[model samples]
Target: MWEVMSDPQSSLALPVTRLTRRKTLDQVTAECQSHDLKRTLTATQLTLLGVGATIGAGIYVMTGEAAADYAGPAVLVSFVIAALACLFTAFSYGELSSTLPVAGSAYSYAYVSIGEGAAWTVGWLLLLEYGISCAAVASGLSGYATSLLSDLGVHVPAALSQSTFQTVLSGANLTLTVGPRLDFVGGLAVMIVTALLVRGVQESARVNAVIVVIKVGVLFVFVGFGLQAMHAAYWHPFIPQSEGGFRYGLPGVFRAASIIFFAYVGFEAVSTAAAEARNPRRDVPIGIVLSLVICTAVYILVASVLIGIVPYRELGVADPLAIAVNAMHEPWLALLIKVGATVGLCSVLLGLLYGQTRIFFSMSRDGLIPAAFSRVHPTLRTPWIGTILLGILVAIATATMPLEVISDLVSIGTACAFGIVNFTVIWQRNTRPGITRPFSVPLGGITIGGFWIGIAPALGIAFCVIMTLPLCIDLLRALGNGNPLPAILLGIYIVIGIATYFAYGRSHSRMAQAPFDAD
Candidate 1:
């Protein structure tokens, strides 16, 4: 990996345009900038941003599902495998944070360092990863809300909560259908996050930190209470039946790794907050690894308790934790867990939205998308337009959908981006000898950071691409007679991105037009 960049200066991005020196880009460009988003986040605030952006239905709900359907009590091992994989990739991120410390996460880094086309495509993918993924998160939050309401004596009417088809079917059986409703809770959370982010990164991060505390507190409560009911029997035969011998003499860990992979979603968010960090070199790496480690530890521990309390067969379902508590004859605890889930999801939605808007901000700045999107509001200092646009779209998704499709899509998208980060770090390491590094791998012997992060990306891309083809074929076949517009729209999104880059971004790109100069 270290051999790839022997003479970076020869191939490195010489400043494309001589905009100015010793002047932060935001200040010089602020006047022309499309958005008013402020940069006030500190290291701690960024850490909380990492924390807030991290958890959601993945842990509270998906854990049991993994245990039951995929891994069983050995799901804890699955969590470990996934965490270790992320740990590897995060190290590469730590290296990049020290070197580039820019916003746009990996996309921005790729653009300025790699070339115009790479940046544009990565930026497009980041949108799918962060923006669409957040929408997916909001949808997941809505599902959790329904489960919470059911725990209480009061339940939502089916017409409000269930999908139109589910409601129709249930109504045929009984006079009324009980269902999960779509309150604006998911949408409202996005709004609140937008407001905070609008206020400034510093303030928003502080608020996010507080929310993270609550979310973590909720997880802890579950862990502590759930631990009381733990039984070791669940740990027997950790690796269940599998197709081949792999990873641990059984492919179970790999299978578990894929299913539990989404649990580690928030790790990349540190890269997103790179611009606001005081010391990107130092803090970005620290925050990324620190947060990933802490979260992984928590996940494994909590998973252990979840399995200990229940058998593997019963753990694999949506909202597994609540379902587990329901089994303990402590339905009331499940109710609280349900309510806690609602609160935890609040932080998840807000954090994911915060990340989504920033990606657009970077893309707009780079001239990838319409420069109009980069504009800041004069008074609010936030990207009000972009925030509102994303908010509405995500809100609608939350109102009318299930978590399955979106969740898988997000995981696949995220994995693709993750793979890129790993390779980029390796590319930089081999080429840029003088590249400044703020943080390095916690263990610096051989560079494994690239490989660790690369696995998920590999797995994600392979799986998603594989999965997408079948879905597309089915969708086209099923909807040929009906409105088939959604399928058509998805095709247009990518085409529009490629078209926009060629039509506009290419001409305006600093790399293409400006001369090299050290900033």
Candidate 2:
């Protein structure tokens, strides 16, 4: 949370009033006064937006892998665990979105409920979460793109599948390695998302709607068809201990939950879309909770069906969906699923990019980032520059970096965000009770304060830290000296944020000395 720097003489941002900004959090929220875009969405549209964001890429790929690895047929339990955690955080998010409907999504909410420092931290982490998610989805799209090319008997060398520093091309000499291919397809997907968003919010939301429907339909078909082939015996030992189940009890489930947390990443994307939402007060809450329920149900059913049809060990880490279908002797079905998966992943990329741009928009408007980045397109009504620039950066990273590293890193960042959100909710309920709150946690409104909000996040952070330890030790051992790269990156971002805070946000913040910017 931000420490309020005392400034007796302060010039607040324009057109805001009433609530005095004696703190950094108040100053960060001044842009609610300068909202250029008007509400154009309905509650159902908001709910669909959540669905559109949640149920795409993860369902296609991650479910099968999670099923095979941690819970065997019981990976359904893992999905349940993830959903439970999300429900708790969504409660906090929904309450905030209704109370403060703006472009910032969680970052904006954080600024209002927590402080400028927390908002900055969430904004920076959001870059890693949503940005990396978009890149990962783009890469997944490339897998389909390459396979489609192969189908047409025009296979680009795998080396040319993406872009990156992998292939050493010295003019007339091309040395191919297992690095980045020329991921032209991933580039195409990014361009498509960029163009759609540039068109307008309604246009982008509608496109996302269509994508969500088709993707959800594909999942339904897979589950229904795959169910017919399920053997009850396959679920013989439901939690299938020796058959890929955990010997160490809940540890296996928790580990799986941590990894499976990746699937839940984009569900929060809906909360970020609250800016374009017509009825954020009503719809934001409905959209977040409903979409999560739908995704969780689909996830549980799919995981159950996979283990019933195939042995856990046979279901390898790579391409478990295709492997499961193949094991059922349905080559035609397998081929079809690949097509569906590739297409569905496009929506995931788009949704993730949408989330990233909005978070950037929130930060820029708050003076946490450059003011230039806060400019909404006079026509598009979106943060076009932030969208396009971030896209280019992601294109370069995913095009070149290996999938495994990207996947793992994204998981870490996303999990951290979840922990913070959970804690932020509890903090607001307990510490900042004077603020407006339209929705709330049920009961222990004391217990929630005590256990769910307070204790859960503290432990969640500890768990994430423990997971990070292995990575830290590995990096240190690999270099034989603790690599300064990670520390340096963290420090640089923090320093930049501190500079931005003091330079612009400190003095000119409407909330600094005057009221809010409700202009």
Candidate 3:
């Protein structure tokens, strides 16, 4: 087996085959040609797809939670911090996507720049990131859907609407109980989005573009009304003093930044569509950077207005935007906000499902997993099988897991992927100096001695690492609090991933059987 093979030339403890093997750019491009997808997505549609994916349930839900629980009104600062981290990573992604122009996003970049082992790790992490994230967004969609239906005098049964785990709070004590209920609404949302994705990418993009418009328009309406109803007194102490250690102080702001960082998770999904992009090089970069900038601006404005309209303490709810709308006593606008959140979260699930399928497609093509995952629809030119399978898994997760648990796993996984991508750019710049890059990280002339420093990617790596620390602390805290199921689940996922790679992927990798070509 490849995992057991030893290098006779080296005395190192680890296997050289695992560390030294890399897929060349030529092979990746050739593989893409062999299994080509329809290129129907333009820069504009791609940007909207990104916006649709990103400006979803997180902004609607996490804003209130972050403000009420962690940063107070200073959640605005947290958004800025998270946006900065995403911005740094966006530049690195822009460069790599233009350079590789493959379907796997960071995973493809890792295969070419790093090695198969690292690529497998990244691919595994992305599965966790996109899969859990879709489930998380679906769970949020359930809340918005229930709220909207309730306003129309349609009541969903509590047993059918809620997740298996129920949280009960009595004064200072918090308790979680396992129940027989299922989040049927959330599961239904995932299935609906999966059907849209399996149809075609162009159709999905068009639907997403329309949803993006409605959602953005709704937010603008909230901002306009919220500014009118602003309470100046709420802005007095922007960063509220901490009642305890990491709650509502400077530390709380950083922690909230890590939490709300999930809002920007969908931007990188743009790169995963490179294989389907009309012009991968130009469109992917534009879609990524443009979407990040636009979403960050919108998030800042919405957070400010939301906090201004209601005290930060009162803003924590499943639907913060709706809460703010109702606080103004505008019933009509509140209804619109609820409808907008449902549409927004629908698009989020679609975008995530799209990205997840493409990642599996790319990994399967490289013989990292089952080739069945790479199977494209004869007419739709989509990874139908993977899409359906992933959708089913996400539906199951949504039906069972709590939203907060899934959200935290997504944040941690995405942060890890971003950190690896940053390092990939840095490594590629040093090793493949002669490779023609359609887009390059700017300000590379600034050097420390002989090494040309990439300020953007360097900061990207630092920020990603910084953002991940809090999530790690939160995970440890969860375990300490006797809630070890999530951590144990994540450990099991890693073990399965590692075992699969060594057992199947190592022997089946295309790069291993083919001769290494420098070009």
Candidate 4:
């Protein structure tokens, strides 16, 4: 059904087109069956894919930074809050993926439940989420790689190992300034992962699974040794007294959750694999929820041990885990930690890069973007052109952007995307009550004002709003204080999405031209 522009003279008027057009469930499922992508992924592989993507940067890289800067030892509380929020959304994802079973993840769900315009918006945000996340993970990987190389008597120059730009504080104002250093290691890492992804999903998944095991084991070793070195005094003031604004206190804990929420970004990547799963209805849901459950448990355990071993203030470095291991006075374990972090973050890059390409592939297939993105390699069945294009852009970002800057942006983008994912469940439950749902959100819902809202999805939406509030508050506070770069970047991205839709997507959308596949 087309939505006609009611006010033709309005500044924001769209052409009389199907901006709110949605795809039928049948149509989505039919495309899933007929897509050119190979369907070789099993339940176990999909779960590992989620684990591979999720377990790396959060535990190995970001935990220490979050502890030192935001929550101190209470970062464990931050993890619990973030995990609870994500669990609600994860349930929503399981429901939608089982019902629709398509590529594009939240973007695809939005297309089916909400409209094309919303889908475009979600897809664009996903680009921010997955693409920025790749750069963030790569940055963390570079830090660990540099530490490992230095241990092996190989020193990488600061120029090649560090970011090209740094965030500077001048009397209260935070601004990003360019530097001569160029994170060559991080950029090169992205290109290597991109090449592996282009080889095919099965090959990538196999590699990711092996690395997942290695990293998990390495983390376990850290916990074993870390406990021996635990300083009970480190947990004395678990909730540090407030220094000023959100630096160390209860407020800081929530703020920490907002930042570390980036840790859970990989859980949704499983939904993006719907088109590639051998039994999407059965396997995708299992993958989405199971991966999150396992990862959350691991996050809490590792974080508990990490903070117990080191003073929170000392964890602000890029290689926080390495710092913890070094304090253990075990050079061998420290070396092992660095190696595991390097191998582990590579899988994160692979999973996120894969997700970004698949989202573009789905959008392109719908004629909402360029057709080249949808074009698959004849033999490999991967979106080669799109993969390469996104990879180069991610590499450039990794080379230029700092970890702290990009990680916050990724969390914000990911939270917004997840909110929409939760809402899709509520919208579809009401609008298409008869649709077949192979898996449903565990908790039942209630009817209000004649609209049915699932318990899990409603909570998911609320948690997302809660998760986003602090990050946005922090962003605005920074702007008011002096830092405007992150806010400006987010504004520019939203504007670009709006412009791109009117200039190309609206006209090119298949829904605008094809007969309405009405319910």
Q: Estimated TM-score per prediction?
A: 0.77, 0.81, 0.94, 0.95
**Per-residue CA lDDT of candidate 1, range 406-426, in tens?**
454455555666666666665
Across residues 1-519, which tens digit of lDDT does each residue of candidate 2 receive?
122233333335221222222233444345555667656777676667666666655666676665566656666776777677677667767777777777777777666655555666677677777886777778877877677668768777866676664434454333435643567678777877877876777887777778777777777777888988888887756565543323213545554565577777777887887767877778888888788888788777777788788886566455677777877797777777777777677777877888888887777765556666667788768777877787787777777754444454566666666667767677666666677767665534336425444454444455555444434443444334433444444456558756765676656443444443221
Candidate 4 local lDDT, 92-128, one digit each (tens): 9999998888888899999888888789989999988
lDDT of 3 by residue, 73-187 (tens): 8898899899989998999999999888889999989989888878888998998778878888888899889978999999999788889986665553345689889999999
Provide the RMSD of all predictions against the true structure, rounded to 1 decimal. Answer: 8.0, 6.5, 2.6, 2.2
Q: Best candidate, TM-score-wise?
A: 4
* Ten residues in sequence with the least summed lDDT for candidate 4: 8-17
Candidate 3, which segments miss by more than 4 Å at Cα?
1-16, 166-176, 445-450, 516-519
Q: TM-score rank, highest first? A: 4, 3, 2, 1
The TM-score of predicted model 4 comes to 0.95
**Candidate 2 deviation (Cα RMSD):** 6.5
Clashes of each: 22, 13, 0, 0
lDDT of 1 at 193: 60
Clashing pairs in 4: none
Model 2: how far residue 407 lies from native, Å: 2.8
**Which segments of model 4 are wrong by more than 4 Å?**
1-17, 517-519
Residue 181 error, candidate 4, Å = 3.7
Q: After best superposition, candidate 1 residue 471: deviation in angstroms?
A: 13
